[model samples]
Target: MILRTFGWSFAITALGLLAAFLYEGTTALGLVAVLAILEISLSFDNAVVNAKVLERMSAFWQRIFLTVGIAIAVFGMRLVFPLAIVAITANMSPFEALDLALNDQEKYAHALESAYPMIAAFGGMFLLMLFLDFVFEEHEYEWLAWLERPLARIGKLNQLSVVIAGGALAIAGGFFADDPGDVMIAGVLGMVTYILVNGLGDLFEGAGDVDEDSEDVKRGPNGLAVATGKAAFFLFLYLEVLDASFSFDGVIGAFAISTNLIIIALGLGIGAMYIRSLTVFLVRKGTLHEYVYLEHGAMWAIGALAFCMLVSIGHHVPEWITGGLGAGLIIAAFLSSVVRNRNEDGKNQSSADKELHSSGV
Candidate 1:
């Protein structure tokens, strides 16, 4: 099943390379493959994180994710969004931005590098909020009067947290503002955008029923169906957002290496394919749950991702070191989990053998 799902991704990736080579050349094709792998490696956690969301989704949305969703991620987020950012930040027309990106790779790269902090700040806040909400927010959504009261209290508090965070972010924006005026504006925009977008996500969530294991009541008549539908939709949305967030980094960084749109597309395309394939593979194999703290490792990776963005915005972190550190954290987490599991198995086996001997003649 894993192979079958990934097979198409592999094929399309190969075809993409073939097309790139035919049209662009060996260098373009090679760069695409490398970028694809880099993207996949960096995004392993994304897949695991996504699987947790995906498992809650209905089959229908999953189908959409594997199809239309990938295209949005590949073309829209990776290709278009970067150009859009370039255009907006540099005060150039979109075509002009594209021309600069393709023709003046060095200048384009410098522009992107300069903008890294702002993008990082935005992406980091958004992702951190997502992680927090998922980890701590009450998932129960029952509408009973007694249930609603306590739930309302918690919900209001969570909203308050958002307000507090927004305020804090606005303050930090002052610190990060290279130009006080521009920084203040970017910061405010970031805060307001985060509030509006996340609030809407929460509002839609209210229409659904309570999760089965959660204490909250189901709001809908067909609780299970509503929950499933909502979960699917949100899961799909989450994947798109996560893909876009990661793409911001790659798209920005890719300019540092090459300006050719085809080359950029090829490299990023290859990287994206690997990420998709690996995500599917990990999900099908249930690697996330099996690895115990791998998700924690991924969370740590997210933290690193946040730090990398912040550093990249102003400071230079060698790509090799940045990527290596994340890779190392994951490997260490895996090894620790393996050791812990082995110790657990030993204890269980001993208990079983003793029980059997004690029962026998």
Candidate 2:
């Protein structure tokens, strides 16, 4: 299972490193490896969240995610995105931005940095909404029962997630942003993007209920009706937006390591492939079912990352801090899951022994 899932990722990693070495010797190879590892560490939570959504998708859509989705993630996000930001912020044409990126990367990086406030506000709020909605919704498993149960109860209030997200935006804009209006606008747009994408998905999925008996619809991992057709398309759209939000931090952070666009693209692209493969592996193996708290952990990590992004508007938060916090939370959740499984197994074994004794076996 592991080999089947990760074989392509390994192949790509090798090819990417080889290309990097050919382009700029051993130093470039080492940087590419580091950047790839950095992307994986930062996006590990993203993969888990993505798997939760991807499991509902059909086989064909999953293939789309691996193919078309990868191109968008690798080239679209890693390369064109920064250039677009530079072009828009620097008041230059796309060709000029590309020229700047290729000929004068320092100026390109500076131009991108100037746009960080909008980027941070947009990505931060989008991720914040995702985290808020997840925590607010009631779930079968609660990793932190004391916190999650209370929040879940409060979530019964209509639009509570929106209220909280709006409040957070207000706080971030008022306190953290140099230009409050721009930050507020970007943050609100982020919130709106989430609402529109998620709402369309829900709307189409609800529409699917009319034809639930049809072969195109099927039960998802959660036993709820899984979306197909237009519904699945919207869900796929949501996944892409979610990935873009996750990539915002990584893309910006990559500039700190290397201003060379080709190297950054190659490295992050390799890591993205592995993340996509891991998401598919999780779905196929039913890993989430086996480790109930993993999703919760990933959501919490996302919440932390959102908070960090917002805070980073006025302060510098190291990349390691964001990555470490996420890794720690996930590791803790995995350990807790192991303990839970052992307890359940012990109870089952004891019950079986008692039944055998009573039956005179």
Candidate 3:
């Protein structure tokens, strides 16, 4: 299963490394490798969260995510998006931005840095909304009952997530952001994007009662109704936006490692491929069903990341800190799931023994 799922990622990684070596010798090859590992570490939880969403998409849409979605993630977000940001913020044409990226990389990095507030504000708020909604929604299983139960109760209030997120945005803008107006606008847009995309997807998916017996209708691995047609399209949009949000920090942070855009793209692109493959692998293997708390952990990691992004506007938060926190949460959740499964197995064994004794077997 591992080979079947990750075979393409391995091929791409090898090819990408070879190309990097050919382009700029051993140093470039090493940097590309490091950047790729950095991306994977920072975004592993993203893969888990993505699996939760991807499982609900139909097979055709899932294929779209692996194929078309990958292109958008790799080239669109890793390469073009940064250039577009530089262009817009620096008040230059696209060609000029491209030249700046390829030639005057130091100046290009500075331009990208100038746009950091807006980037962080938008991505941070969007991620905060995702984490807020997840924790607030009632679920069958609770990893941290003391905290999640209370949050879930409060979540019953209409638009409470939005209210909380709005308050956070206001605080971030007023205190942390240099240009409060731009930060506020960008943050609001992020919130709105989440609402529109998530709301529309849910609206379309639940437009009518699902008929289990219908040929088109199917249950996902997690037992949710699979989204199809228009609903799937909206969901696809949500996924892309979510990916972009996750990419913001990585893209900006990569500048610290290498000003060369090509090396950054090659490395981050390779990591993106692995992430996509891992998402699909989880869905196909029904890993979420077995490790129920994994989603909870991933969401919490997202919340931590959101906080880091927002705080980073005023303070320099190390990438290792952000990556470590996320990795730790995911690992803890996986361990908790293992313990829960073992307990259940022991209980079943004890019950079987009792039954045998009672029946004089």
Candidate 4:
């Protein structure tokens, strides 16, 4: 199983490298490699969080994630979405925006750079809320109900939190966005996207069953149709939300590094493949539970990214700092996880040694 999954990942990575070569030769391939690694490093928490949602999905949806979902993430979010934004915000027709991007690269880059703050802000807010929801909210742990009790009560109050946060950001965004209408639309779309995706996840999860002793088993909804259908919806929804969140930093960062839209898409598009592969690897390996604080670290990264974006709206935040801070938090989490795993392994080994001594020696 490991070999097969690794093979798939390698194959996809090779394909992305090939695409980069075709588009812009070796330099583009090098850039794609860097971005791909950066994205993977930046999104370690994303893999952990996604596993929680995806474990509830059916086998069919999992396949879709590996196959069709990559296209949506790369082409739809990374390439087409930016073009669409340029068209809508710049008052050019879609075709015109495409023409400008392809023909008038300088102008297109200028227009996109102008809109970076808005995309960052929009994507940043959405991701921040998501991070908050996972980190601050109470989790449902059967064995830890005592601990979760208070958190569960607090979690119920999240609707108000969401409303206030979204409303305040919307108002603030009006001042920063180049196209207030477009920002508002995207904001609404993002929230609705979350609702729809999470709702579907609940539905599909309801339809499943598993052994009680299995720590891996996620509780599905109680009924058929509605539950499975809902799970499927949320599964797709979760990926989209995550895709949007990841896109914010990546898309804006791409503009900072290079203005060529084709190059931007090609580079980030290659990066997207690595993210998808990472998500799958996490799911198949049950790596989520192993990496204890990765989600917390990710949430921190999201919060930091959101704040940086807000500041960048009116002022400027250095890219090194923004990217550096995120990378640092994730690395810390990974190191913490390693130490924890080592400690647990030591304890288990000591126990086995004692048992063997008692039995015979």
Candidate 5:
């Protein structure tokens, strides 16, 4: 199972290392490896959330995610995305942006950084909403009941996640960012974008519901139907936008270590392949269903990351702080899940033994 699942990750890592070494010798190789590791550490929670979505997608779409979707992730997001951002923000052509990224990388990095407020506000608000919706939903298996109960209650209020996100944006715009108007505008746009995507995803989800009357649906003796068409397309779009939001932080943070666009792309692209593989593995292996609190941890990690991104607008939040908090939350959740599993097993075994004794086995 491990080998079947991680074959691409291994191939990609090997090829990335070889390319890195050949391009700029050992120094570039080390940088690439470090950045790849950093990307994995920072975005591990993203994989968890992605699995939840990907599992709902049709098998055809899942294949596309591994093949076609990966190309978009590596070339489109890792390479073209920063260039597009530079083109838009710096008022240049695609070729000129390419020149800036390759020849005057510090300037390119600066242009990207100059647009941080907009990126942070947008990505942060979207992530904040995603996290809020997840945790605030009532779950029978509450990880931290004391805190989650109140959050669930608060979530019962109409459009509470939006309300909280908007309030956060207001606080940020009023007191945090130097350019309050731009920040607020970007934040509002982000929130609106999230609502659109969320609604679209919800619509697609509704469409995916099983209809016994529909002749288009193929079924086994079990009479289950598959999801496809417009639903899958909208879900794909949602996943892509979600990925872009996560990449905003990574691309920005990579500059702190190196400004070479090739290095950044290769490094982060390698890690992205692994992240996607992890998403698929989680789905196929039923990791989320097996580990009850895993989703809780990932959501909480996202909340922390969202807060960090928002704070980073005016303050210099370190990568370690952002990444570490997220990793820590996920690790804690996994550990708690393990402990819960052991306890459950013990109870079941005890119950079995008692029944056997009573039965005179």
Candidate 6:
């Protein structure tokens, strides 16, 4: 089953390596290899978070995530998004931006570097909100009780996330951001985007009415069409935003390694493909269900990444540190989950033994 899920990831990694080799000999190939590994390590948490949302999606949408989603990840975010950023920041046409990226690589990289503060601030706010929303909400299965319970209680207040996120933006824009005005605008937009996407998800969640047969479809008010179809579409939009929030740091960090967009696309794209596949793997194998505290761990890692990104606006936070912190949280969560699982098994066995003794003659 694992092989069936990950087979394409292995195949594509090889293809990506071959493409890297052909692009600029062995050195470029090694860089691509390193980038791919770095991307995967940094993004496993993304896979875990994606699994929670995706497990609710239908089979058709899941397949679309693997296919249509890959194209968007590779071409849209990896390629066009950077070019658009360069174009906007450098005050150049798209063609000019492309030319600068191709010919004047240093100038293009510098433009991106110059824009980092605003980008980091925006991404930081969005991710921070995601973390806060998760932690502050009521979670029945409390992994970190002392930590989570406090946050959940705070989350009970209306518009608390909005207030918290706004405060975060204020701190970021006031102290850390390069151009405070621009960074504030970007951060506000990021927070708004997060809120809107989450709101939409809340709106659409009832469309499917998963309590009923999830596969069953009902007609909507506007037309005789299926209600679930509209719901699924909105859910997809939310998931895409979730993906963008996760990838923001990765896209920014890739430039630290190489400014070659093609190389960046090839490498990060491969890692993204694997992450998507891993999302599916987790859903199919019930990995998230089995590992109870995994979601808590992923959210904590996201919070850590948000902190690193915000700090990077004022100071340099190395890629290794960002990746390492996330990996550590996830590992700790996994270990904690395993211990809980074992304890439950032992309790069940004890109960069974007690029941047998009580019934015996």
lDDT by candidate, in order shown: 0.64, 0.90, 0.91, 0.67, 0.87, 0.83
Model 2 lDDT-worst window of ten: 214-223
Q: Which digits, one per residue and each the tens of the lDDT, describe model 6 over residues 95-180?
A: 99999988887788889888888778778888898898898898869999998998899889988988988887888788877688
Task: Candidate 2: list runs displaced more than 4 Å.
Answer: 219-226
lDDT winner: 3
Score residue 136 of candidate 4 by CA lDDT: 48
lDDT of 3 by residue, 33-133 (tens): 99999899999999999998888889889989988998999999999999999999999999999999999999999999899989999999999999999
* Local accuracy of candidate 5 as per-residue lDDT tens digits, 1-361: 7887789889999999999999999999999999999889999999998887877776777778887888999999899988987898889999999999999999999999998988899999989989988877999798878899998988888898988999999998887898999899889988888889888877766755656444323332223344466766777888887887887789899999899999999999998998989998998888998898898898899999999989988987999998999899999999999999999999999999999999999
lDDT of 5: 0.87
* lDDT of each residue in 139-209, candidate 1, tens digit only: 33221235434634565564554564455455545554465455445445544655565454444545444
* lDDT rank order: 3, 2, 5, 6, 4, 1
Compared to the true structure, candidate 6 yields what TM-score? Answer: 0.93
**lDDT value for model 2:** 0.90
Task: Give the Å shift of residue 84 in candidate 6.
Answer: 0.6
Candidate 2 or 3, higher lDDT? 3
| Regions of model 3 farther than 4 Å from truth | 208-216, 219-224
Clash totals for all candidate models:
6, 0, 0, 12, 0, 0
Residues 49-157, model 4: lDDT tens digits = 6665666565566667767887888788878888887897799998999999889977887887777766766666676567556544665322224533564566677
Which pairs clash (backbone N, Cα, C closer than 3 Å) in model 2?
A: none
TM-score per candidate: 0.80, 0.96, 0.96, 0.78, 0.94, 0.93
TM-score of 5: 0.94
Residue-level lDDT for 40 in candidate 5: 91
Q: Determine the backbone clash count of candidate 1.
A: 6
